[model samples]
Target: MSDAVEGGARRRGRDETEEERADRMWQELIQEVRVAQMGVQILFGFLLTVVFTEKYDDLTNTDQTIYLVTVVLGACATGALIGPVSLHRIVSGRRVKPQAVRLASRLTLLGLALLLATTTASLLLILRVATHNGFVPYLVAGVVGWYLLCWLVLPLWTRYRHTSE
Candidate 1:
């Protein structure tokens, strides 16, 4: 809130201009997106092949529905994760880096959330098909809890504990 201006441009703790900050943030976001994008793309690719497998026909109706939903979620996550690259390509040299960065960040977050849902659904379908046991939901819940702890809770806690603003 107390950022000061230098050479007519407001400076943050890093003393960088708005353009510099946007560039730095854009690089970091792209790196993060690359990692997530690769994983999601691979997952989505595999999900696409599921229907061609012989085992797919053996799945119960509910399992088939789950599989369908998982594949759709995975596709959506892939699109969202890749959206920043497309956005950057289309908006390059437009002097809208800051706005683009904000939109890309939001897309990345949405992609991550969708990825979680897709993975959870896939796991549920796989376990149900593989085990056909009663404790599958409990097992899936535990794994989901682990994912939430690792993906969401710890990051939030760290941010809350260490962030000054």
Candidate 2:
């Protein structure tokens, strides 16, 4: 940390005002949220229609329960992902952009977790119904590993590898 960094002239190689940094970060966060929000909302919408399908009645009790949990997770994810917009709207002129960004980032992380659970549960339910075999769980677990590698591990590795002090 240098005086130049603290003086708000430069941070992590970007030279900008505090307000400009906040605005840029806010825009970046919004773009990321839009990507995740669309995904979670569409998944939630599809989950909502599952119970109305004629084939839904054929699901076993266990599968029905899984579907119920998945739908709930999807709903939770949708709410968490959309929460930032409402938060920003309510606090728009409060001069709290920094705090708002932190809170919104947390909400996005929580939403991603919920989305992961929803996706895993939905896959479990679907594979169970489609295969009706003991191997379905193992298959789902492998796919979950893939999701973790793609979604979490790669990003972390990149960050760790490229970050400068």
Candidate 3:
């Protein structure tokens, strides 16, 4: 096994060139984005019809506001997740895959954050509507905490523990 060192820093295991690495990263990113994009699009589609539902008028003003905010968040998440595809389409053959990949990765991260917010808001609204209990906020908070642990904390911890920079 050979460990290549560059610029006084240890190189990662992959031996691919920049372009090859970018190509591989782009494919992986797109595959991940496809799954997220589909879910976001479906959630957004459902959100779009919420306002027209007869029960919509029965919601309290607070709940209605939550729904509106959730819809907007979902829309933003959808856009960010889909942005990479458009970015790739416009930048193809431009010899900017590396830069595009970085930008797309940022967009994907932003999309995930937005998705977290959208999901949290939706969960809050649903729980408030379904339970009508005083513990709804606590329940939502607990679930959001679980999501933060599962989606963000664990991944960052694993990366920090297992990888060197």
Question: Which residue runs of candidate 1 sit more than 4 Å off their true CA positions?
Answer: 1-12
List the global CA lDDT of all models. Answer: 0.94, 0.91, 0.94
Error of 3 at 16 (Å): 1.1
Model 3 residue 2 distance off true place after TM-score fit, in angstroms: 6.9
Residues 28-94 of candidate 2: C-alpha lDDT, one tens digit per residue: 9999999999998888898899899998999999999999999999999999999999999999999
Model 2: lowest-lDDT 10 consecutive positions: 1-10
Quote the positional error of residue 76 for candidate 1 in Å: 0.5
In the predicted model 1, the residue pairs found to clash are none
Candidate 1 vs candidate 2, TM-score winner: 1
Query: In candidate 1, what are the lDDT values of residues 112-164, reduced to their tens digit?
Result: 99999988998998899889999999999999999999999999999899776
Can you give the lDDT of residue 78 in candidate 2? Answer: 93
* Model 1 backbone overlap count: 0
Across 48-145, the per-residue lDDT of candidate 3 in tens digits comes to: 99899999999999999999999999999999999999999999999999999999999999999999999999999988989899999998899989
RMSD of each: 3.9, 3.5, 2.3
